[model samples]
Target: MLSVYGVAPSEQLFKGTSEAEFPAFHGRPVGGPVLVDCKVSIVKLGSHALGDQQSWVWKPVTQGYAVALENQPLSSLKNHLRGLRTLKDESGQNRLWPWFDPRYLKLVLRGLDGDDLVRLFGPVTLFAFALENGVELFSQQDGSLQVKVVSKC
Candidate 1:
């Protein structure tokens, strides 16, 4: 099974459910919290869904709105991801990190060192993102990061 997380820019573009979704806040909240509808959501994809929408899903992924990872248990993975939602910046202030965004993900994969990558990846054995004309695959081997690109045919 593959774990997929995505964000819809607008409500009209959102077709998924709110079952396992959360709001994407800009920064740390100040006074009383204000609630608003969010388009961010997570879903698990099995072989059947992947087989059917392999072409469909890849397009949006290439546009940097979503991402996929493998080998982590659902509950644990969700918790792990939740833990990563906030990051401390240079000034030691909490900031929202949309790690699921493919654009941000690409930067993270390239910027982080081996040790950081290991922690960031956690139990995810494989990570994939679609490019303009190909798919980028990331994995770890012998304490190193390995990347491969499969061009669309």
Candidate 2:
């Protein structure tokens, strides 16, 4: 399974590196110029270099600066996430949905059901993130959201 992380710019996970080292792309569409500082980035994970830097990265990820997804090609997963960036509001206006942020993800998950929930999961078979005391894992099973919480030992 391929593991990918959607990292928010505030985390600065790639501050001192060249794009070739981490190979990240913004979540926004490809046709226009956008502010890189304000966009969410999609990056592949599990490299030896990343493992070495885990100490610094882990805390930001746990604090909602990133989200993990598994079992999808990088390009496909990026497209899926980009599509979810904006949502129609109650008044029919498009609003930014910061669903990748775990704090917002918890709230977004609560209000999604049936197709809405399934749509969110899309091609990603598993979603995982860390909370203050545990890691939350989300998977779609039998048309519903199934969550597993692994507490810190």
Quote each prediction's TM-score.
0.67, 0.67
Clashing pairs for predicted structure model 1, backbone only? none
Counting clashing residue pairs in each candidate, in order, gives 0, 0
In model 2, the clashing pairs are: none
Query: What tens digits encode model 2's per-residue C-alpha lDDT throughout 1-153?
Result: 555454444444544321112223345532234232253555445532222224324346544333345555666666776776667778998665554556566667667889888888777766666656655667777568887775655
Task: Give a tens-digit lDDT track for model 1, residues 81-109.
Answer: 67766666689987666655556666777
Model 1 clash number: 0
- Regions more than 4 Å wrong, model 1: 1-19, 28-38, 47-59, 63-71, 90-93
Per-residue error at 119 for model 2, in Å? 0.7
